[model samples]
Target chain A: MASAIINGMPVEITPGETILEAAKKLSVKIPVLCKHPDLDATAACGICVVKIKATGRTLRACCTPIDSGMDIVTEDAELVQVRREVLELIMSKHPNECVTCARNQNCELQTLCADFDIRHMELPSLVPDIAKDTSNGTIELDPRKCVTCGRCVQVCQEKQNVWALSFLDRGIDTRIAPAGDISMAESPCVSCGQCSAHCPTGAIVECDETQKVWDKLIDPDVVCVAQIAPAVRVALGEAFGFAPGTNVTGKIYASFRRMGFKAVFDTNYGADVTIMEEGTEFVERFAHGKGALPLITSCCPAWVDFMEKYHNDMIPHFSSCKSPHEMVGALTKTYWAEREKIDPKKIFVLSVMPCTAKKWEVRRSADMSSSGYQDVDVSITTRELARMIKQAGIDFATIPEAQPDHLLGAYTGAGTIFGATGGVMEAAIRSALFLITGKNAANPNFEFTRGLKGIKTGSMQVAGKEVRIAVAHGLGNVETVLDEIRKAKAEGKEPPWHFVEVMACPGGCVGGGGQPYGVTDELRLKRAKGLYQEDGATLWRCSHDNPYVQQLYKEYLGKPLSEKSHHLLHTHYVQRPTYRR
Target chain B: MTTATTPNVQEDLQRIAKKWKDKPGSLIMVLHEVQERLGCVPRNVCLELAKLIDVPVARIYEVVTFYNYFKTEAPGKHILSVCTGTACHLKGASKVLESLSKELGIKEGESSADKEFHLQSVRCVGCCGMAPVVMVNGAIHGKLKPESSGKEIVAQYRGK
Candidate 1:
């Protein structure tokens, strides 16, 4: 343990913990701009400078680790003055469009300015004349508002490893841009939006489509129905002053109804169907040796895109399953439309997701329109849905709880856990066990496939045969698992792992790019734990046990891999070049 | 003053990337060899190099644009640089750049649409005595007035 005195209070810290982390334990607020919980400190923003009482030198708290018996003065007259100067210098270059900025009241810089009592910038604005990039149509880049914090660059290059964004140029001319003067859409960008999640300002943001959804809602002939993803129920409450992990699904359903949606559905229902098809696929390949092993889950659209661009060779290993929301969209247009006695053309399916990739996923390929119409009309992020709720003047706190419309609404605990890292694998194993062994998993809870580790591996026993599996979250960590698979295949070894699950964002959907800002590992864990708690409380914990899913199979689809299920609930993959140019 | 790229830029990039594949943090080094072989790094070469190096082309562009040493495009027929060092800045170098920009219709760090003229600002070049100098294709024209001289020099280039 390391000992330190911060502001005259003695504190104990693990060896090598940074002053910022130690100060956090002491509740010493050290304002930071470029330090993100998910990344290493770039020390680009000089706001967190703290004075050493022993040495009388100022060091950035974010990067400086606590030394033994070191006395740190986090707040002093000189330190405050220096921090104020740094804040002013940064603010001088930032535009005065806070009122209209996407981050408005939530930006870290705006909060810092107010905290430091910075009335106005005395320095002239040298804000760049950089052009806005909306080329991707999923994530937007407003470079003029950037503060050179480097959080987005770090997230893009280090965490995501997609390398779609980089800090171009140097000094005053420094800016973030795609390589080779290409638009983001033409680059290897997966549209995961992890960069936007870690960005401290409005420099990188999700494309706001609240108004577009509102336009569809007011169309008299259009029957706008909404579906809420598993992660949104846990994270959307952060904007409405609810705790980070509070499950607000009931209230979200109510809010959608008040916003003119004709029906409210739960995406968890789709997730359950995804497991049914995917679990069957896994069994067909693993037990009967029908297709490739280790079968990779295709529930995450961002991972699907990444696999197509980066690891196209693994396409044979990808399961032909459409993501949960797409499943819901297809069902809403086909099954639900028939049951509700409405024309599919008159119905508009709105998906409120905790991801920016879903926007791209909905329009990824024509396969998404298997329902004979564009299955999902529009997909909005959790942040956009929160904005719409506020726009509707409905107090989420006072909103009456409501249940989703029945046919495509009910879900199991297996479906709800789809938001967390390693969750899809756990969910599938719980049901795949039944599909293969014809019995419920004696111990349905697989504790090994949990937590925020970059990569998690485990094996399950089924009929005296071992089923090996690996789960990976965060794109950078994905390379190792894929390389291992490649090496094993090259050596002609029996499959190293029988199944694989991947989620693009770290901590899975709970830490998605389109969720509320100020994301951290703690918040991810909290949100994931909320989903797990909801799963634990539910009556049915396995997708095979979802009663509504059984009804769909009995009355409509007939079986898991039936022709109708394959048409509406499954899709294929194609190899994509990283750069169009 | 030679380009590192050969007639087949992609083949050259593949060869260079293969040489540095086992070495970490050698993308910039490989790119240097590419830029040295080619007068300027082309878009397609960057795309091919990204595949060989297993990196996003965005990082390649970031590094290319950061250092003034790497050029992304071939030089224009007429090169113009307005020195913006201490001596020149003190003597209204910005106004001189503005006039040159207006005359040539090209901003600093950009080439004219016709690719005829390129304009940029440079640091000090040991010409303190000749403050406010404009270097045209390596020839120095010093002690210039910001307004009329810029248009006159541009017209001289246009006449050529």
Candidate 2:
């Protein structure tokens, strides 16, 4: 441990801890724009400059590690002046469209401007005249508003490893754009929206579909049904001044009714059905040795797009199950419509997902049209839903807790934990172990695959046989595990693991690209805890134990992996080029 | 599809990238060789170089666009560069450029109707003492008047 005096207060810093981290620990605030706790500091924004007492030299606290006997002044008159100059320069390039931008008042740069008492710019504003790129319907990129902070670039390149967004030009002309100068849709962008999630400005953000949703909601002929994803409940509270990871599921359900959602459904119930199908599929592959080994999960749409583009060789090994919301969407238009005697055409299934990729996933393949109509008519992000609630003048905080509607609304603990990373694998293992052993899992928790680790491995006894499993989240960490498996398969060796799960976002859907903004590892852990806490508090801890899921199979769907189930619940993959031709 | 007929350009890019395979931070050098061979760094060529060098196309474009020497589009058969530096600006460089544009019927940074002559404004060519300098295809014409001298020089390179 190294000792440092930040603003004359002595503090012990751990090895490799940055001065910013030390100052944060000491409660000495060092303002920063580009340094996010979840990503590596790029030192793009120069707002966190600190002065050294001995050398009188200045350094960026974000990228500089604290020395043993260092005396760092976080803020001083000179440093404040320099910081203001930096802010002024950044403001000169960035458009002053805060009142009109989607992230108005919530923007970091706007907040800093207010904090620094910067009402007028002494320097002339030189906002770039670059046209907005709205090529992808999931996200919008307005280069005019960008401050060149490099947060979105780092998130898109290093954190996600998508290689879609990059610094195209250099110096004054430098701007964030897709590789090869292609449109975002034409690029290998999976529409994860992590770039927007990490952006300090409103330069990158989710494409607003709330107006369309509003039109649909107001239409008297339309039966607008809503399904909330497992992750949305835990993170949506952040927009309404609630703490991160606060579970607002019940209030959200009530608000959906207030917002004119004809019927409220839970995607977790669809997640339960997914476990029934995916667990059965895994059993057929791993336990019975009837199909390919190392069956990968396909719940996360971003991972699905990434696999289709980069890892198409793993197509045969992918589980054919649609995402949880898609499954609910399919059921909402088919089973629910048939039972309620509502016309499937009039029933527009709207899914409130904690993913931007789901916006693309809804229209990605034909299986999403399994209900003789579009399964999911529209997919909105958690942030968008929060905005809609506020726009509707609904008091979200004190809203009464209400229950989701009907048979499709019920879910198990396995369904609730689908929000976190390794959740799908754990949910699958919970049911898969039971299917093979014909008894409850010795431990339904499946603690081995839990937490915020990028990649996790575990071995479990299924029917007295050891089954190897691996869970990988954050697309960058997936390549190593997959390459190892590919190498083993190429050398004619046994498959490394029986089952593998992947979620494209860092901490799965809880840290989803469309979740609340300003997400950090601390928030990720709390969100995961919220889901796990829900799982622990529930009565039915396993998918197979959900009584409603069993009734659905017995009455409507017949059985897991049945021909009818495959028709509505399963889909195929198409090998896509990395770059649009 | 034009690249299909020009196999040598692709081969040259592959060879250039291979030569710098062992050297890190040599993307700029590799790109320089590509620009020298192709006259300009084409978008399609950028994609090819990205694969050959195992670097992202964006990274290559970032460096390529940074230096004004590397152009993204094809240039003309003969180049007409006007120095617009402080020394040349004071010496009627803007009037000289006007005459050149009127002679070629093309604006600055544009190619002629026949694609034989291209015009661009550049910084000092180390001949600032001469002032109002203009270079065409590596032949310097210093202290030329804007009247008919600049137009005559441009017309000389029109057919060549």
Which candidate leads in DockQ? 2
* Residue runs of model 2 more than 4 Å from their true location after superposition: A54-56, B1-5, B84-86, B94-114, B146-150
Residue-level lDDT for B94 in candidate 1: 93
Docking class of 1: acceptable
TM-scores for all candidates: the values are 0.93, 0.96
Which has the greatest lDDT? 1
lDDT of each: 0.89, 0.89
Query: How would you encode candidate 2's per-residue C-alpha lDDT over A1-581 as one tens digit per residue?
Result: 56989999999989999999999888888999888887788898899999998787999999999989999998889998899988999999988888999999789999999998888878987888999999989999999988888888887778788888888777888889886567888888999889988888899999888888999999999999999999999999999888888899999999999989999999999999999999999989986787888999999999999999989999989999999999999998888899999999999888999889999999988888999899999999999999999999999999999999958999999999999998899899889878887888666788989988888998966667889999999998999989989999999998889899999998999989899888888899999999999999999999999998998899899999999999999999999977783
Report clash pairs, candidate 2: none
Cα shift from native, residue A249, model 1 (Å): 1.9
